[model samples]
Target chain A: MTKVTMTVNGKSVSAEVEGRTLLSAFLREGLALTGTHIGCDTTQCGACTVHVDGKAVKSCAVFALDVEGADVRTIEGMANADGSLSVIQQSFQDHHGLQCGFCTPGMVMASAALLADNPKPTEAEVRHHLEGNICRCTGYHNIVKAVLAASGQDVPAVAAE
Target chain B: MFNFDFVKPSSIADAVAAMAQTGAQALSGGQTLTPTMKQRLASPSVLVSLTGIAEMKGVCLGADGLSIGGATTHATVAAEAGAYYPALADLAANIGDPMVRNRGTIGGSVANNDPAACYPSAVLASGATVVTNKRKIAADDYFVGMFSTALDEGEFITGVTFPVPEKAAYVKFNQPASRFALTGVFVAKYASGVRVAVTGASNNGVFRWAEAEAALSANFSASAVEGLTVSAADLITDLHGTAAYRANLVKVLTKRAVAGAK
Candidate 1:
């Protein structure tokens, strides 16, 4: 095992990690940040998405040692300083973006990254940007709505939701 | 994944030295390698990550055309290569998803040379030069077969220089589940002639459709190759598509690529 150090969620954290330890495992086990989910260990599912140096990436596909001294962020860091929900998270809840909350963390993280890059993304753009993320429960109708709402765009309500 | 020692080198020389060690494997973006490791398919004793080398990143337009660092992420290529080579940028933009693009690098994809990958079609069709630590190789001689390349052990790609084409486009019929091409075609027209490369269709891996090239070079139009057909004999047949289906796609996509070239 080797000691890996990084700024996680605005805090400098260091841990002893095996060379094979994934960043998702490191965050969930080493630092005790369970907010980042791991639905699929493979790269297909985006449940393990997190921001490494301000860019969203699949934490499970990255070795912890590879991100040494990098700045990392998780869903836990999305809320305001008072710990209330951030705009994206609030929008997700308000729009019923999730049914099973398993994929929420990754969805929120990916959405936040999208808004950062393209603040006013269209409906097609949001769907395209979220191609990596999978949500079985919601059929992705409301999830797309939530992301649009988060971007301050007026989202039309679907009768199904 | 098997436990191994890890090293991140800040320079190419140091990275090469580290890779020269026994049982050391070079790791690029790890988009592909990490998953392979998790599956226990690849277990290196020491993983030498090449992302730390500052010099091996970014996209620049040189006298030859576009020079992209080996370690440069697909996202960077999508964002930067548009002005110089918009077709390449479009291909890069559509690779995998946003998160994967952020982590997957050009060198990793080209070096891994997955039969369904997108970059090899672009590289081979554009007549790009694969620059490595040891020497520069022409695209024609770089790719050997599926998941294989001309690269020897300890020799890693540093950058690739693509000769800008007068008109170029890449058209892919992606396997929706994985977003890899079921059969992709790239057509590039230069002053000298036309080059056509097809990926994801052939068992022999990415290859130039010489017949299509000759036809397109003579006419430079979609109708020029209307009568041409790819033989189904060497095409891949799997649950996703049949060899004949892939063979048909090779022709259809090539026509679309030529018509769409800008």
Candidate 2:
């Protein structure tokens, strides 16, 4: 077992985990921060996305031991000090971005990272940036709208086809 | 994943020493290796984390070319290499996603040598050199085949040096599912000659298309190889595409790359 220490959700946390322990597992099981979901287990699905050192990454694809002394931010940390939803999360709700909600945490995390990098992204850029984050529910129409809206862009409502 | 000892070494020498242990594997970024381990595909006895090593990180551009440290993440390359090598920056920026690029290192990618990986195409086409703890291996000699490299056991890749070319461009047809290149081409024009390396479409891994290179050398334009056909004999054929289809992509991508190169 490896003893690892890291800053998670603005708190210094330590855990004794096996070498095979994934960061997603550590966050969910060890620290009881189950907000970070693991959908596909494989790297293709972005359902396990989180931020490490201010960059979004798949927590399932990283070992807990490898992240020693690193800074990790999850969906749980994205709330305001008063426990309100962050702007991106609120935008998702306003845009009806989620249906099943399995992929929302990862989608929101990935979208937040994108907006952090590119504050004003075009619709095409938003779509391209979300290639890794797959949302089967809502057909991704609302998710794209939510990301764009969170970035302070005026997103038009989707017209019924 | 099997049980393994974890060691984070702050120095390359310590990391190499840790690797000397039986069944030890170096971990950088954990983008690829971690997944392999999670699936129980790789059962290493020890994981020597290279992320802690400060010496093997950063981008350095010099007279020789751009020297990228072994542990330098893809995001770093995408953000910093833009001023020096915009084509490389473009390729780096598009790899995986925001998260993969955040953690995946160029050294790990080249060392792992996945055939569909975008960096091998750029490295081979740019005629970069893979600098190791012991010696340097040219890009031509570095990659052997799919998931293969010339790196010996315990021989660490400190970084790679890419010689800035006169003009270079990388274009890839992304495989929808994994976002890996179905057929990627990197076309570079140097003072010496032209080098065109094709990745994700060949059975032997990333290789130089001599025919395209020679054609572009004669006339540096996309239309130069309009009639040139790629042979399907050595192309890769899987569920994604047939060998013949990949051959077509090779020619088409090469033309587009040449036209796109500035």
Candidate 3:
């Protein structure tokens, strides 16, 4: 086992982890940051998305030991300092972006990363960026609307939503 | 994933030394290796993480064209290689997805040489040089077969030097589910001649379409290869597509790639 140290959600934390311990396992099990879901452990689903050193990546696809001393941000960090829902989270909630909420953390994190890079993404750009993230519930219409709303763009109301 | 000792080396020399140890495997990006390990397909006693090596990360334009560091992530390539080689940048941009591209490295993809991968077609078509710690291998001799390369055990790619082509483009008909190429073609036109590489189709893996190359070199047009056909005898046949279907895609995508070459 290796002792790994990293900054998660702006807090420095240390954990004893096996070399095979994935970041998702480290977050959910070790740090009790269960917000980062692991819907598909095979790396196909984006339910495990998190930011490492400001770039979003699949937590399950990375080993904890590899990211030692790096800054990691999970879904738990995507909130205002007052513990209120972040703009993205509030947008997700208002736009009815989620159904079962299993994929919400990942969807929010991935969208945050996309907005960080391209703040004013178009409808097509939003859809393309979220390609890795799978949302079986809402058929992605509302989720796309939520992401656009989070980016401060005017989103059209979907009849289904 | 099996239990192992993880070592992140900050230098290429240190990484090389770490990889020389018994049962040591080089881990760059870990986009593919991590999943494979989860499936228990690869279990190395020690994993040498090469991403920490600062020297092996970046894209630079030199006399030889674009020299891309092996550990440079796909996102980096997509962002940096655009000015030097836009076609290559486009290929890197479309690889996997935003998250996978953030973690996947060019060296890892080229080294893995997955039959359906996108990089081999770019490397082979551009005739890039795969530079290793010990020696450099030409693209022609670097790729051997499916999931195989000329790299020796403990040897890892440090970078690749691509000679920028006058015109180049990569077109892939991806599997809808996996987004991997059902059949991808990369066409590169150099002053000397045109080189065409086909991936995700051939059983031999990422082979050059010589007939298409000859026709394109002579006429550099989509209609140049209208009469050409790839034999289905050597193409891959899987649930995604039939051998004949892939064979047809090879011709069709190659034509499209040539026509779209910029």
Question: TM-score of the second chain in each model?
Answer: 0.99, 0.98, 0.99
- By DockQ, the better pick of 1 and 2 is 1
Which lDDT value does model 1 have at A13? 96
TM-score of each: 0.98, 0.97, 0.98
Off by over 4 Å in 3: A157-161
Model 2 alpha-carbon miss at residue B210, Å: 0.5
| Model 3 lDDT tens row, B109-190 | 9999999999999999999999998899999999999999999999999999999999999999989778789999999999
Computed on alpha carbons, the lDDT of every model, listed in order, comes to 0.94, 0.91, 0.94
lDDT of 1 by residue, B154-261 (tens): 889899999999989999998988989998999999999999999999888899999999999999999999998889999999999999999999999999999899
> What TM-score is obtained by chain A of candidate 2?
0.96
User: Which is superior by TM-score, 1 or 2?
Assistant: 1
Candidate 2: residue B86 lDDT (0-100): 85
Model 2 bad stretches (over 4 Å): A157-161
Indicate the worst ten consecutive residues by lDDT in candidate 1 chain B. B174-183
| Model 2: residue B29 alpha-carbon error in angstroms | 1.8
RMSD of each: 1.2, 1.3, 1.2
For each candidate in turn, the interface RMSD (Å) is 0.6, 1.1, 0.6
Supply DockQ values for each candidate. 0.90, 0.82, 0.87
